[model samples]
Target chain A: MKQWMTLLNKELLEMTRNFKWIWVPIVFILIAVMEPITAYYMPQIIDSLGDLPDGAVIELPVPSAEEVLVASLSQYNTLGLLVIILSSMGIIAGERKSGVAGLILVKPVSYTAFVTAKWAGAMLLLWISYFIGYFVSWYYVGILFDTIPFIDFIQSFFIYGLWLSFVLTITVFFNSFLKSPGAVGFLSFAAVIVLIVISGTFSKWFEWSPAQLLSYASTFIMSGPISSDVWAAIILSVSGIIMLLGGSIAIFRRKELA
Target chain B: MSVVHVKNLKKNYQKHEVIKGIDFELMDKKCIALLGANGAGKTTTLQMLSGLMKPTNGEILFSGSREGDDFRHLIGYLPQHPVFYDWMTGREFLEYAGKLSGLSKKDSKKRTQELLELVGIEEAKNRRIGKYSGGMKQRLGIAQAIIHRPKLVILDEPVSALDPFGRREVLELMGRLKKETAILFSTHILNDAEEVCDEILFLHNGRLVESGTMEQLRDKHQQAKIDLEFKEDAARYADLFTALVKVQSHAIKRNKISFFVEDIELAKIGFLKVIAERNLPLVKFEISRTSLEEVFMKVVEK
Candidate 1:
């Protein structure tokens, strides 16, 4: 337990020093802030455009605060997730590649602690940045449109957080066996894309897959607990994260650190 | 004070075996040098011993250790090219390493401070490790390895890449560390091993070719040889010595003459008698023993 905490503290310190603390959050916040400003000014932006020709009229329906927040989430799914994957691509691979992991493991540290601490660190960085950005979106939506109910905001927020957790977990799992950080990033992106593609193509059969997390979160915001599939998805997603993290530990222990 | 007994320790990468069933003992508080050429399984053996790499088929038993024991606390390790969180200061890295070794926060701080002083890097402890020179990083590596007072410290070519000054500094530190803990370090340079280690294990092509103390190795591989330096060119005396009965072979270079003999004691008396009787100019004459280099060569070439 002490060794795990020690490594966890070291990981946090590394993040602080390596500029991850500053840049990761900045990227997420920028993505968060982009949605509301663009949503509110999109009509005016279209009005100012000369492409529509003189006195041309294009009817634009103003999206609700809940809808704005949901649209903001799409940005998170793309740009925000890209930042998370790229930033955390080297979390374990870098350490093992550079030979630092061998030094620590020779001490009284367990392989379980070593692998989990890395997962925990990446999770912490993900959630911290995500929440900070989510709160910004909340603030902007309150000012521009009708306020979302407190219960609705919190539920959707956690669900989106779970989705982010699932993505980071996939990245961590690939990181254990992959040599190149670049490959880890590519494969992580590929793995999520495959999951979502399969989920999208076979929606009826794969309704409870983690690929449905963003929609479940959106549903929670617009309405409350519409289907038992959301509950099943929540359970499966959390278990997926736990299982991947456990698998990473098992891989780290089994493979020679060379 | 503990002994590490490695029995038929083997490692295979894919199908080709890297460490071919090697066996050796790392005695209590004694420095053992794993001497071998590149790709000779020196690093692989050290890695297995450090618990960084698992052996394919072997039993590495630590004295007094029970089955399924978490004995890693008894060992510390440094790689050939150790990479750290370059952003961390020397002091911080040591403290972090100490804490990982299961020390309390306060104890970690205290031990880090002591190690910094002991390793003579106290002046630059606050500076980031990335800014440290090769020598400073090496000193820090040794300090971290022994911070927990482990029974064994495994170093994989700890000084192979350093300049002369850096090598001397690290060599001095290793010499001092032998009093506290057992050290297993790998080096291709025979002189460094001869100078620092109490015992040498010659690893060649993934096998334990030879293992013994320098004295024992020297005695076992010693030949009946004598080196004679002349006041002038020694070529004139070479043929005269080669013609003698005890002299098996002779070689001459510049002002020196080397004689390989069947009986050193008998040959020495015969050669000295001729030198005095013939009024020859003999500046230096001494019986020679096989050096560690020759022993290493014979072991590896075999």
Candidate 2:
């Protein structure tokens, strides 16, 4: 038990020192503050296009509460993906470069412990960032509209963070196998694109695609009722989390620390 | 009792055998220096002994057993090119290494400070390792290796990267470690080996060509040397000296005539008689003892 803690501590300390711990929270906060603020003011900026020409009845569609939720979520989700990739990119890939892996592998700790600790620590940091961002989003949206409640805001953002966790887990798994962070990041993004395209083509497989997980998150925040499809998406996201984490540990164990 | 015992050890990377069937024993608390040219299987041997790599055949016994897990508790290793996280301080690096060696948090902290002081890096202990000079980094590497008081420590070319002053300091630290642990290090620098090692294990062409105490190895290759400086026209007396023939071999270098002889006392006696017979001029005449450097070069070549 002590040995495992030592190994876990080493992993966490490494993450703290290497800029992972600090940047995740900063980026997530930026997303949180920027999301609702952008949503609240997007209308005025669009309307300031000035008076239309005489007889040119160009009527702009009214921005509703649904539009506010969707626009804010879209912006937040982009930053959320960035935080996920940035934090998970160096989990194992950096260890291989720094020769830190050599020091830990000689001890009694198994490869299982090494990978599991890396994933768990990274997940913890990501979750913390997501929560902070969610709180900021709720507060900022409330400042914009007095009627937005905190509990409803959390419920909407929780599913988005969970969906992002699945994507982050995949990034962590690829990080273990790939030689460079650039390669892992690029490959993971490419794989996500392919999955999105396939889901769009096959209606039956939409629930399994991680894209649905993200899309349904925005649907919930717009005050739309959670459907059977949303639950299915949640179940698929959980399954993905398991496969990614399990595959990472297995591949990492077989890899010889060169 | 031997601290390390390797029997029929073999390691292969696919088709090529890096470490062939090799066997050796290291005695307790003695500094053993491993000398081999690059690609002579020195690194591979150290890796297996430290449990960083498993042997493909045979066994490595620590305290008379092949238990890999507990065996590492008694072994500390420093690789030729060690890697460290760029952002961590020297103290953090050693503390982490100490913890991995099963030291408690308080003990790890205490030992980290002690080792930093021992290696003369106490002032730089809190600085990030990435910002350190190569010599400072090497000192940190040594500190971590000895932090846990391992019984057997293996360092691979530990001083090869340091400057002359840094080399001297590290070599001195290693000399001190000789009293506390059975130190085994590999280096191509013959002088470092001569200065710090009690026994030298000469590996050549993937085989143990010679292994013994420095004096023992020197004695095995001992040949008396006679250095004669001529007062007047030494070149003129070269033919005459070679012809007298008590010398095994003689090389003329400017004003000095260096002769390899079978017996120093016999050569002295013969030299005195020849000087009297020829009434030759003599500036200096002395017999030289064989140095460890000469023995190392000769044995390694064979």
lDDT of 1: 0.87
Best-performing candidate as measured by DockQ: 1
A112-193 per-residue lDDT for model 2 (tens digits): 7677777778788888877886676666666675546555667777887777788788888898787787788887777766
Clashing pairs in 1: none
Once fitted onto the true fold, the runs of candidate 1 whose alpha carbons sit more than 4 angstroms away are A47-52, B228-238, B251-257, B262-287
**Comparing chain B with the reference, what is the TM-score for each candidate?**
0.89, 0.88
User: TM-score of predicted model 2?
Assistant: 0.87
Q: iRMS of every model, one decimal?
A: 1.2, 2.2
Off by over 4 Å in 2: A7-19, A32-35, A46-58, A76-79, A107-110, A145-151, A222-236, B13-16, B67-70, B227-242, B246-258, B271-286
lDDT of 2 at B136: 88
Q: Candidate 2, overall lDDT?
A: 0.78
The TM-score that candidate 1 achieves is 0.93
Docking class of 2: acceptable
The docking category that best describes candidate 1 is medium
- For candidate 1 chain B, the 10 contiguous residues with the lowest summed lDDT are B242-251
Q: Report lDDT (Cα) of residue A124, candidate 2.
A: 81
Q: Write the residue-wise lDDT of candidate 2 on B1-302 in tens digits.
A: 68988888888999888877888889888999999888888988888787777788988888755555457678787888887777888988888888878789999999998898899999998888889998888888788788889889999899999999999999999999989899999998888998989998887766787888888887788688888888765777777766666777787877788788876777778777887898888888888866666676778776
